[model samples]
Target: MTVLGEPRTADERRTPDRRGAVDGGAWRARARRWWPAAWGAVLGAVLFAVAHRAMPDDALISLSFARNLAEHGQWALTTGIEVHTATSPLNIWLLAALHLLTGGHAFLAAGALLAITLAATALWLRDLGGDRVALLGTALLASSPLLGSAVGLETYLAVAVLVGLVRYAADGRWLPAGVLLGAAVLTRPDLLAAALVALLVLLPGAPRLWRALPVGLAVALPWHLFAWWRFGSAWPHTVPIKGNGRGWFDGSFYLWNSWPDFFLVSFTGVTVVALATAAGGLAGAAWSLWTRRWVPVALAAGAVVHFAALGLSHAPPMMYYAGPPIGALAVALVLAADTVRWGWIVPAGLVAAGVAVSVLHGPGWADGLAPVRQNWATNPEYEAIARDLPTDGVVYSSTEIGALAFYCQDRGCTVVDGVLADPGRVDQRWVAPWRAERPWTALNYRHYRPPAPIPARWRLEMGPAEPRPGDWPITRAPGVHQVARLVPEG
Candidate 1:
């Protein structure tokens, strides 16, 4: 018989069973701590897969650089050209590595990398605003048509880096925060403006700005120096190509024409969410300044500064440029919502409304779920032109060089980017002839012209011109030829 308050037999003690119970409880605790993040990751992956069903046209340009870097050991757009045209250095390197790893399937590799980044962004937001907001933000971001178009580009990765920077800054980890901001700049040079605003917000309260500033400069300076040495200018060649000869920060065309589209694209076609985000972002900035909450202040300031920079630069109405600002607004909104009772309701409503709008106005599920087939159907002309050319040919393509280079991957052919090549060859003579008749055309070729006196040994071919589909005033007037061609002098 067992004595009261004492052990009976050796079996009664059951040491192994007690240890097992404790081990099981520890396992359960660990799972509880990790499961939410795991779920967020899963949700992120699923949404990314749905959103990233088509690759953007610009991705092919980056892929060309990545392919050349991986296969031919060249950093230029074309082998042996030594031109520094790649806009996203970090993205180029990442895609290069993935190109090799995935056996030259750069698009697949880019999609996978984007999915992982999206998941990490979701997890970071989860830490900031609990499971509900995180899930909602992820869903909204993933469903965004702009974000969908940006899947194969550096935009989402930049957004993820911005989020990380803000998170680290908010926690007073200045060094890592600076590192991330620097990384963001590497991903997209234009993010420098946004980074400056964040640093300004961090500087007053966080006295350790010195600790971060040097690190950020160190990360970004080497690339700039290298670009200067290699390309004769630290700026991307596209600056001269697309800046339309205007000084940087000299204009506001984007503010007037592209601002509304920015909001529409960023908010996934939902006007209500866009308006709310703008209102909340501005109000939150003011509130944060009053309360001296530097983190939200930094986010709000970054959004404003980025938008202004884009406006000043007269940037094209591309949705990807809005990624970081939208992300900042979302984070600001979540943080602001947390201050009020039942704060989760706002994000939840935004998410639901965004989803409804997407369903009503965006692509249907059948199209959304469709597998990403090879882009050959839409780009058959480029492929045909590529195939018809000789293996060692050099083709000068006007606008669709991305598709041209991508399809010509195996032909040992090289593409001279019409917009970006031979800045020194630009002559006022070329523009004078067309200025009065075609002002826009004159401006496009004002800063660059094809290399003169093309050697007989080099073959030059032009892609067929696209027909203007409409009779709109802005459309190419009838009988005006789209002169996207390169022909050697007779």
Candidate 2:
């Protein structure tokens, strides 16, 4: 009814640049601002599917906690007794919220969380670095087999929070940065060192930064306080279970994880990978400092600080713990690019080696899914054992309890002979805090373990030398595994 060239009245149509009506430019602008995140989401969703297939047995531990928390209003994996085995409060809570909101399983919740966080991470990285660098960083994260293996865990969430913290801190937005800093700690307390290092490096002369500390503490304090009040400790039960053991998070361990297994395993391989890594890091740090590329430098500093802290403390370096630092290092390396002169050689060599190894590493990195390594076991196999377990009796599993408890539909029913479920340590004192007060008789500690008497009705171990009847094949692993039934000790 209107002429094509005529101007429209206020009641009619608005111009493209105006705020009133549907505008193509606005949508284009939004799409431009968000395309990187879409790329990241696609990458994340694909990887999550892969990880879900081979989801580690340990990862299901937290998934179960989340499921039980959502369904039962209790923090315990098993019923009755409340335990603090979940190391990441934020991870479980996020999973719980996702589970409740969508009425889906915990793994589904985890996959959704992974995609969202990675998308957020990509957008932040875009803001911190330019589009090309951001995409590279995202690729590095999405391609890592280690992160793929760490699905259903806090690593994805913490990395996203860490990236946001770095982004805000670099942009001089102290308040939001502080909030993310606290979230990082809550997600993975070990990230504290990384946060401090990033802040110190990024804020050499920034003013009014003191407010960030108080805000961060405010955000993170209440949970620790509540935990201490209820669980008799401020940290997760895992701190005692695996903390202070040596060689877990050290340089050799990091190197081993960074490269493909065939590329580096022996002492010579470890040494070469370590040296190459150190050289690449130093070059990146130098270039970042010289060019005032604050994010890359901050990222590198975080990796160094975390590795040093864990290594110096002789902390047990579990494989799952490598994600954040390794991820940070990867981002830094990709962002650093070529330095002036001969310095480019180091980063180039590093990049070349990593890419070559990854290309040869197979579909794990290619499809952006979890790697099926030689020895470790994963989801379905563990779930099979868990379903096979009798919930009526105390099924004592010494090796893999996480997937078992989750599948057994936890109720404090399946107790392992491990310190992870030390029943009621309300008044307990550590004899040797480093080793989790293990070796009770000689260590002079009485932190009570859920006792499993010998010759019980069910004994689940790592299994016999070879497969026999009643043996369950851990599809992810090449070994004998079968639950044995014995005469009741009573």
Candidate 3:
């Protein structure tokens, strides 16, 4: 053949053109299909932020502690104190790493944690119900406000354990799963009860139980030993020492108050959706058992048992405690859905509504108190105080110690009863005297003068107040020094 005569025919090139056009169209269609999921993730983050408007003081304390740890290798849980009573510093260690990676922006660290949770939830759903079903579950989780609040390194540690549970449950990998669960327990002991129930599910055959239980026990031993040494007993036991949430196993208070509160936290979505999903999940298990759907039956049952066992405890329920149930509800909703063409719209709509409501109504602890609102550590008052005061020496303040300690970058300043630093040590006797309606004087202290011995240098800072005749009125009294108002120098 001559040089130009050996060229290919038009048919071959023309056929490829048609095929390429078809491929392009297919890609466009796929992108259209996934657009909803893309939008859902974006809106989910927005909803999450709106729901968690007020940062929890406890979270802030943890953030501060983590910052101090990563920055300076500080080992103490309480600022400027050598008290090592609190057990297991793993959560703090993780958060400190997160802070260091994020260059110390707590918000960015929180967002990163959220993204990881979303990814983990997606992976779990994919394993359970294939790609489409998993996407639905991911959308629901990403949009949930309660889970959003839990999106931090502190919460990520718990989520990692959950991922491990799902992973091992799918494949029956005993040792690694046990180690992960043990780590979760160390991070938060409330998870221990749930992890135990999950372990029972994964290793149910009594013949193999003897072998597997030891494996898990081996993993959990070191944390327990460290905890026992630190807290004088095993486990941090936050429920007992940290709060006054103790109650009898009777019918009155536990039934009415505790149970109702627990259920309320669980039922964040539409009442109908919540109740129907729960019912369907139970019914599915029953049907699965009859039809030999042993896997789903086991999973559903394990989830329910874990939820009920932990939920029916004396510690009192919080939103974070409802994580497993929330996850169960997500699974149930997906199971109930018809994942056909345009079927995801049902769950997507419900998730959107729930997220909207949560953002609008979630509670803020710092909303009502005037002093707390105005004189926060982030405010100019604390900054001015920090600038003027001696840096090496500590300033004693009541009711805002945590904020002062964090914002002033001075570990020496002390505030009374900040939930983070003080925990159970902030006694009511001290708090009542510190925040008495009027200044403490001879009349008020005739019976009791506290803190039985006040520090000589630390004086009471007071504002203008109306005096009552009988109460301890210390207006213009000796040792009542005015904290001079100082503005920023610049």
Candidate 4:
């Protein structure tokens, strides 16, 4: 009559002991509840590792800063120069720590750090939404070529911190939320707008609001003070350089072209999933507004801030810019799924199909591995140039400054960034060159050569030089003097 310390009735005995059946059913339900998120976390880590293998040139710039910090005790893009050019101070610090731990393997360290961050984010998403929405969101992000391409950047880490801040704020943990928001700002200064939105969400209670404000300021103030003291500004020189001369129409054009181009050109199934998730996010925002749910409202507001800031800025709408928007879409989809339980299935299936296609017919793991090989094999030219230069020579490169500086770090040649190091010193004529060439744009200014004559022992130019057997062509435009030789006297 007793089964596992519980009394069993005669009816149960007649029913052949339903307790085991009940326990089995409960176990199955628990598995259903937890399995998708666990699987999603694993998948996210794998995808992030693959995507991060091909480190972007910008990431290399950050790595150079990290390397300098680790090896030479300098917080600059180029060692021995004390400059506040790092956009993400926390990211640089973290990468520097990783570099130290990994014996200076910046790329591998970045990949590992990114994978862990992304996996943890996926798990946290599951706690916010159920397993289905978590899986769906994680799959969509993992399948995105752009998101993957941005692995070495701070995009994912910033988003992970944003999600954490929202969760803490929703739980009324004001101080922790504010601290995380501040950390997000350190990761990406543009998220300051999102931090403001979060503050608004916590404003209903005066005590909580007051507590969060000081905590956030406390975390963010040190870096600002240091930057202001060191650089005379709390912002990097890149901001002014990039912000100058931006057309009114450039932002609008960038916004219009970004999402559409990605969807049209990227894998079809993933695009469908993205579109559906975005629709879900819009609907969820409306629903949250109607219901007066503060968490979803704050998240939607943060997404709006991110999109508006990037869209209105002088920066081009690259794929990584979509990271915050995609995060908002995932949260909105999760909220929407809570109301209509089965509605997540369609998008989930699209994401699953996208993953399947990527594995079966796409590059799959090769995408991540190719970058390591390419970076190893392709930078030989830079090394050769560095080898050819004298010990006291200076090399000025326009576009590949990060790669070139990295290669020439210990070659006794001083590397100066032609564009970003000091834009104020750049001659406007070199940036806006005249003669028979293509129309100029804002990006051209970032790669402009200096018009000043070289007064150094030696100066080597490594851009589009005179067409030679192995010379890299900087541009294909005919009659464009893409030669990298001695600077002629003006």
Candidate maximizing TM-score: 2
Candidate 1's TM-score: 0.73
TM-score each candidate.
0.73, 0.78, 0.62, 0.73
Please list the residue runs of candidate 1 whose C-alpha ends up more than 4 Å from where it truly belongs after superposition.
Answer: 1-44, 51-53, 245-256, 260-276, 284-292, 356-392, 411-413, 421-490
Give lDDT tens digits, candidate 2, residues 97-163.
9999878577778888888888998998776655665576676677665566677778778778878
In order, candidate lDDTs are 0.59, 0.63, 0.46, 0.59
Give the per-residue Cα lDDT of candidate 1 at 413: 64
Off by over 4 Å in 2: 1-24, 244-263, 266-282, 338-376, 410-417, 422-457, 475-490
lDDT of 1 by residue, 62-125 (tens): 8777888888888756555545567788898888998898998876777667767777777666
Q: Model 4 — TM-score against the truth?
A: 0.73
Please give the RMSD to the true structure for each candidate, in Å.
Answer: 11.0, 8.7, 14.2, 10.1
Clashes of each: 0, 6, 1, 0
Model 3 lDDT tens row, 1-490 = 0011012345632543465557786666455344444544454466335433344334545555666677776644445442232333566666677778999875555555455545555555554454566566666655554554444325544543554564454355556666666675666665555555545644542224334356656766776675445433353434333233444435333322543444454343433344444555566556545644333454466557656655465434344445555555455455435333564666777567655645454343223111112122222334344445444333445434433455655535543232224433432332333335336323423333222222223422334444433222221212332333212222
Error of 2 at 229 (Å): 0.6
After the best TM-score superposition of candidate 2, give how far the Cα of residue 258 lies from its true spot, in angstroms: 12
